[model samples]
Structures are given as C-alpha cells and as structure tokens.
Target: MRAQSGHDPFDLQFEADDDFGPSSDADWRPAGPAPSERREPVEDYSPAPRRRAEAFDDLDAPRPAGSVGDNPVHDMIASAEAAFGDHALPRITIHAFIERPRTGDMIEHAARDRRMERTSVTVRDGGLSAALLAYQNQPTPPLLVVECCAAAPELLAQLDQLAEVCDPGSKVVVLGAANDIALYRELMRRGVSEYLVPPLKPLQFVRSVSNLYADPSAPFLGRQIAFCGAKGGVGVSAIAHNIAYAISEGLGANAVLVDLDLPFGTAGLDFNQDPLQGVADALGEPDRLDPVLMDRMMARCGEKLSLFAAPASLDDDYNIPPEAFEEVTQKVRAAAPFVILDLPHVWTAWKRRILLSSDDLVIVATPDLASLRNTKNLVDLVRRARPNDTPPRLVLNQVGVPGRPEIAAKDFGEALGLIPALVVPFEPKLFGQAANNGQMLAELAPKAKTTEALAQLAQQISRREAPVAQKSSLLAGLLRRK
Candidate 1:
C-alpha cells in the first residue's frame, strides 16, 4: 500500500467566486457602485380601523380575520427556532500579504476553518507596501492582515502610510518578525487590532481573527477527548471507534472522530468508509478548512456522525509538526460539539502534548507486564502534568485470553491505583467478525459482554451517569467463572 501524506487524496480543490472578477484595463482600480441620481416618492399607507371587542387588544387575543400578523403563536415558535439554531458567524473578508510561503500557507489554511466559512480570504506575496498600494483608491475590507519584515523604524513608517488609506471601520492585524515590545506597543496605540510574531501556528492565526468578533455571552465551545494505547496492537483503535459510535449514535450529539494515526489509522475501515480527502487533507492545508470544504471531505456515517479518516499510506512520510496538529485539532473542535482523537502509541513531543492537553484521556491496555508498565508511566505523567484534570481512565482489553497467564483485574487496578473503566475479554470471533464486516461491536452483538462493557465506558466518558454507579468487576467475574 502506498503511504499517503497531507495531499488531498480525492483531489478536491475549492475556488472562490470573486465578486470583483477581473479587470479589462491594467490601470483600473475598484470604485464601489456609482451613486444613484434618481429618487422616487416614498409611499405611505394607513389602514382603516375596525371597531372590535375590547378583548381583541389583549395579548392572548386571536388575530383579526385577515391581518398579516395572523397566527402569532406559530410565528413566535418559528422565530425562536431560527435564533436558537443560528450557527453562522458574521461574514469577514481577509486580505493577507505575508512574505514567506510557509507562513502564507498556514494563514490560508486557518482562513478556511469552519468558523470562517462566510469569510473570504485572499493571501498574496508581499508586505505592508503591497497592501497599501492595493487599497489606495478602493474601499478596505472588513479585516486586513499584513506582514512586514523591515526594521522597526521602516515598518512603523510604512504602517503610517497604511493607516492614511485605511477606511474608518476596518480592522488591521499586523505580522512581523521583530521581538521589540516598543513596536508592539506602538501598533496597539495606532489602533491595530492585533500584532503577531512570525512563525505563527494555524490556531494562533485563527484565534486572533475569532477573538476580534467574539461575543462574551456565546455558548460554550466543544469538548475534546483523546484516546491512546499503552502499546501497539492493544486494541486502542477498536475501543476508540466504538466509543465514537456511542457518542454519535447513542448520545445523539454531532460527533467528529479524528483519526490522528495518519499512516495506520483504522477509523475508515472500522466505520466502513473510504478514507479519502479527510484529516490528512485538512491538516495539509488548514487555511482551506471551512464548513463547506469539511462537509465535502468528511465521510457521513449517520445523521449526527462524521469521520475524519486518516490516509493509511506508506508512500509518503507524514511528519507533521506539533503546532500544525494542535491547530488542526482546534479547528475540528470548532466544527463539532464533540471530538474524539484516535492517537497512535508513539512517544514523541507532539503525542505527549496531545495526551496532556485533552479534556479527557483514555489509555487502553491489556493485562500484561508491558502494558502495565506503560500504563503506569502514562498515568503518572498525565496526572503530574494536569493536576486539575481527572486521572486518565484505564481500559483493560483482551483479558482472559486462554493460557496467557495474565495479571488479575484487581491486581492490575491496584498496581495502577486506578480502577478499570472497561474490561473486555478475549472474544476473538466477535471482534474479528465486527472488524471484517466493518461494524461496531455494539451493532454486531448488542447484548454481548464486550458490548455492554464498551457502552459503560462511553457513558462514563460522556458523563451521562455518575462514575461511582459503574461496575468495574465485569472482567473479574468472567475470569472467575473460567
């Protein structure tokens, strides 16, 4: 199998419908619509009043026979539904002139995040001077981001020129490579919306734009859950897939499952969909990840479920930086109510950051010496790093495999000082069948012991029920019977 990297597997390309289109003359500049010269008299209306019972004016009164305000209750309900479900943010347009292609690429990817779907972005090569000349005679856009690599004094002088041509209501975000506090202070004093240093992460760029228009009273952002295995071949992928299924199918929330194991992810296989133009594509160019593009890239599994499948390829080495992954994950969180990350078992800096920063973490292991040692290490590290967060939930999978002399569930739990949230047995036939058929364990055998265990784990992580109400002895009971 060919290894796939961040290239768009399905070759999906997006082209914005430019309202300005093109110009016939090289010297032509945009001058908004010409002023109208004609005016018409405004029509006024006065409806004749009808004599009615005093009760007609009451708040509870039925509508008068033929008025436009008929069916007040239905109108009220419709209005409420519209307001309650409104997810569209205000339309913003970004024009960025960054000197570096890599920086420009990151900015473009952040521009296409779902939050900016209604926002139009055009990134070009140049700096503040280019931005100034482009808008010399034209109206400035809602948002303008420009970069300058000149020395501090020269940059300040160029920005003064930019400020002269900037219209009254436009917001400006400045980018530079200087580390001078005086320059940052000066930009703020000149009404610059924000000033960012070079080597910007995609998330940093996106957040700067988002904060400019954020409402203090808006609803809470989505929750993120990260899942990783104690060791490879320990069934972490299967567990992550099943839990994601529960969150979407059982809980009825819009869920996005992000398979981060780019080279060896199994979300597509487990969910039975083609892994084309998914997480890899989004991570490859975060600037193009708005709702419309993501909708096309994601595999719709069910009404409320979408899968950000990984491109399991060997042809390309997917060596993404930690910062890029962070930005992609945040944008994914912004796109859905719940996000589940299927992390691979690799002890790198990025992986450690992912595990430590998640809202919830699940570490899957089996009852063996290697799993136990690794689980203990991960648990201690997570606890020490995130003192305020609850400990990582332990899941013991493939327990009670015949003749494999495993540690007792009680002993394993005692050793780690954390009880097992889910203990699945070595039911090879059932798990294998489900994998081969591309179905979740719950779908294959609803009443099976393993399915029940998975459901419990889902409920715990989703906080649908109290953790104390859960039974951790499911596996121990099965083992005792044997």
Candidate 2:
C-alpha cells in the first residue's frame, strides 16, 4: 500500500506459470554446465533475462505433458479451493522492486492473479540510500521482491535500511545480477528468504516467492470480499452489511465492513451508529495510515464486527482517486482477517479497481427484468475485468412480491446463466421493523422467515454450509417447527 494515490487514467485493463521442485517450489531444470555463481549476506543476484518469456524459457525443458488438473500445482490449487471460494477476497500482498522494467512487467503478470490482494512495483533507482528512502515510509509489504544489480558493498547499507523499515515478519526475496553462491548464502543469513540469479523467468520469480508463503497459515492469505450493485436500489449495501455482520458474529470470525457508499452509505444506518470519520478520514491522508491509524478509523459494533464506515456528507466531493482505495484496502487487508467492501452502484476507475481486484464478489439483485439484465451484464463485465478471479455470487432478493409481475426463480437463473445462491423472499414487515430498530435481522426477528433465510445465506458465505439443492422456505420450516 505504498502511497501513490493518483488514478493513472492512462492505463487500461485486459492487460495480461509454472513447474517447480523442492528448490523453492519452482524447480526449473537448470540448463547445461552451470554458469559462475556467487553469494553474500546483504545482497545476491547474477544476471537474469529482463523479459518474461526468456526468464521462464530457462525452465521450459520438456517433461511428460499432463493436464493442470493432474499436476501437483493444480492439486494444491484444488485443495485450497475453499480459501478461494465465492464471495470474498483472499488477502495477499506482493511488493517487488525491479531494476529492469521489462523484467518487472513480466514478473507482475505472473503473480497478478494467484489470489494476491495487491502486487505493487517499486522501481529500482539511484542508489542504496534512494531505494531505502523510497520504501521507508511504506510498511514492508508482506512479500518483498527486489531485483537489483547493486554490488555487495552497496547492498549492505541498503539491506540495513530495509531491515530498519521492514516489519520483523515481512518476507524478503532478492534477485541479483550474477550467480554469486557466497552472496546467496549471505543474503539467506541476512534474513532474505531466497536469492536468485537474474535473466530468470516470470515463473521463477513467482514460484520462489509463492513457495515461501503458500498456505492460509502464511500472513496475508486471508479473504477480502467486496459487495457491489449493477444498478441503484439493487440492495448491495444492505446485503453487504448483513453478510459482514454474520461473518463476524455468527461465524465467529473477525470481519471488517467498509462502506464505500461515501456520500449515501447506509452502513452506519444499517448498523445503527454514527462514527466520527469514515472512508474520507482514511483516504484523506493516505500516507499517515498504519495499524494504529486504522484503529482510529474503526467503530466496533459487536464481538468480532468492526466497520470503516463512510462519512455521510457532501461537504466536499469525495473525488477519491484510485490510489487512495489501493492504500486503504491494502492496510485493511493486512490488519483484518476478512474485509468486506460495500461499493456503490456506480462505476469509476477506483470502483472498478476495487471490484476487479477484490478477492471475492457478491452482486445483490431483485428478480425483475431490469435487475436480471443489469446483473447479467455486470456478471459478464466483471468476469472479463477479473479474468483471474472466480465469478461473482448473485443474490436474488425480494422474490415473490404479491401482485407484482416477477421473473420465475428458475427462469431468472436461466436468463443470467447463473443459479441464484440465495433467493431472499419478500418480507416488508420484518425488514422494515429491523431497519427501523437499527438491528440485524437475526437480532430484530430471529424467528422471522427472511431473518432465518439471511442466517442460511451467511452460513453459505462463510463456508459453514456448502451449496446444495434449492432450499425450502424459511416460512415453511417455521410452520413445520410450529
């Protein structure tokens, strides 16, 4: 979350591997006679190809071809699938410093999708002091990857500075200019997790780092889910709030609900409390944010639920840039076990980034012609926007309204090309009473039909309950119990 809060309205999306072994999980069959190698305490790296294809080509030697499904990589992926399940973002941050731009770009592509919360690039520049200063203000992002050609003498001071600025827990990876065995040994001793010779492929860079922190136990691999609407009145905020509340309290997990509905956010209203500063206070000064700063931003609602609520005012235009979002969410990812973003029913560079990069997505909708169409388009667009992410969950809401022309549940699902995970039936009486009382459905009317339904939805989202055939009506269950 290095603070560069400017929206590069310049870059567009649609932009943009691996076999490995015990040697850092990306065991590449190193070519013929080994080239000269060197190692050191402060720094280590031999020359590596700057472009992606060349870097990976070194490891592309022929092996028995097998489908990704059968590969160990894919098996790990499948077992870890629940962590990548529907409706939330996985928490992982990758910060890389590269001396060469092409090589840096290649590395960026290889790691962009592996469910990383953020991949930040800090260009290698001037000298050791400069690099240290550039990264000083920022918290040592969880996984630090540095590609440099600096000499051992020069790297010593740089590592010292990095050690000072980096948190004790941060993982550091170095890519040096030459295969210096001594330098490699030295860096590993100095606390760098891994060091590699340059002219390496994107897969090499990706594989080594991924191996260092591969499971949920690793620091930043939690989940981050963002809730958004395809159109206004699509019930995005309400659903997001309810889900976050359930995640924190019902599921016994630590959860943070961020209300990005800035001007008109309903989080405070939904949770029934007003906090001092909301998203504005966090984004207003992106540089000053840290775990302590985040403590100042949150308003605790219950045992495990906290909120970064939006300031409900138009005192000044939010005009928040994309970078502001990057910083806030980055900090949120580091601190919370789960972060839920209640995005407004609008599109912008910042919002798009939030949606596209979030670990999981939930689109709430009413089952009508307009909701169906907008949800369908949103699904398609979001799928494209995040080619690497799983599809967004569709929540069909307010179904079976009396005397209203409504889309049949099955027909609605068919039209959208996605089955609705939870069909929340119409219950104006209970919903209104709960809202008026400033209470969650479980609290306001725990026995009510829709409230019961909300609880089931929460269970499904938190993975406490897996998906199954269509559910019976909560009202019917209530009657049966009676």
Best by lDDT: 1
* TM-scores of the candidates in the order shown: 0.53, 0.57
Error of 1 at 218 (Å): 7.0
Error of 2 at 159 (Å): 31
Model 2 deviation from native, Cα RMSD in Å: 14.3
Best by TM-score: 2
Report the C-alpha lDDT of model 1 over 299-352, residue by residue, as the tens digit. 998898899999998877887778878778877877787889999878888788
User: C-alpha displacement of 230 in model 2, angstroms?
Assistant: 2.3
Worst 10 residues of 2 by lDDT: 13-22
Which segments of candidate 2 are over 4 A away from where they belong?
Answer: 1-209, 212-221, 465-482
lDDT of 1 at 381: 87
| Span of 10 residues, lowest total lDDT, candidate 1 | 39-48
For model 1, what is the alpha-carbon lDDT of residue 411? 86
Off by over 4 Å in 1: 1-220, 465-482
163-277, model 2: which lDDT tens digit per residue?
A: 6666656777776654544445456556778777654544345455556655655446346788877678867777788888777777778888888888888889888889987
